[model samples]
Target: YADALRVAQEAAEALPIEKDAIVGANFLLGLAQIEAHTGQSKEVVKTLRQLLTIPAGEYVSLTRLKIDPVWDPIRNDPGFQKLLSEPEPETVYR
Candidate 1:
């Protein structure tokens, strides 16, 4: 878990913010998984928040967070629970 966390962190950092949004989301998902597995609830929730900022995609979703066993460790975290309960933000386009 420690190794996985380290690698995920590194990969996430190495990703270019503009060009790799989707890939970065995937790395965030991996980091969240590692953090949850290693009892780092705070870090896991933080990572999930980061993932949530990415546009709707294939990596993480409120539904997955609610149901996936991988996120069970942080499921009860206030931050995580708040994320689940909050209404989806309104997206506006010009």
Candidate 2:
């Protein structure tokens, strides 16, 4: 578990922000999942919060987040629960 977290974190960091924002954000999400699975609640929330700042982060599906089994460890966490409760942003089309 620790090794998985380390590898995911390193892969996320090594990704180029400007050229691989989407992929990097996804990697960060993977890191967060690993943290969650390992019982690192605070780290999971912090990592997820950082991922939310990336533009591609908006593409993450709230419904998917709610149902994903990988997040089960942190499912009852207040911070993680709060993140699930926040309304997904509305998209406006021209």
Tens digits of per-residue lDDT for model 2 on 1-94?
A: 8899999989887984555866877887888888999888888878766655556435455676788777888999998898889875453221
Q: How many backbone clashes does every candidate have? A: 0, 0
Give Cα distance to truth, residue 59, candidate 2, Å: 6.8
Q: Residue 74 deviation, candidate 2, in Å? A: 0.9
lDDT of 1 by residue, 1-94 (tens): 7788899889878883355866766776777788888888878877776666667346677877888888887778787888889765442221
Clashes of 1: 0
- Mark the regions of model 1 whose C-alpha exceeds 4 Å error after superposition: 90-94
User: What TM-score would each prediction reach against the true structure?
Assistant: 0.79, 0.75
Candidate lDDT values, in order: 0.74, 0.75
Which candidate gets the maximum TM-score versus the true structure?
A: 1
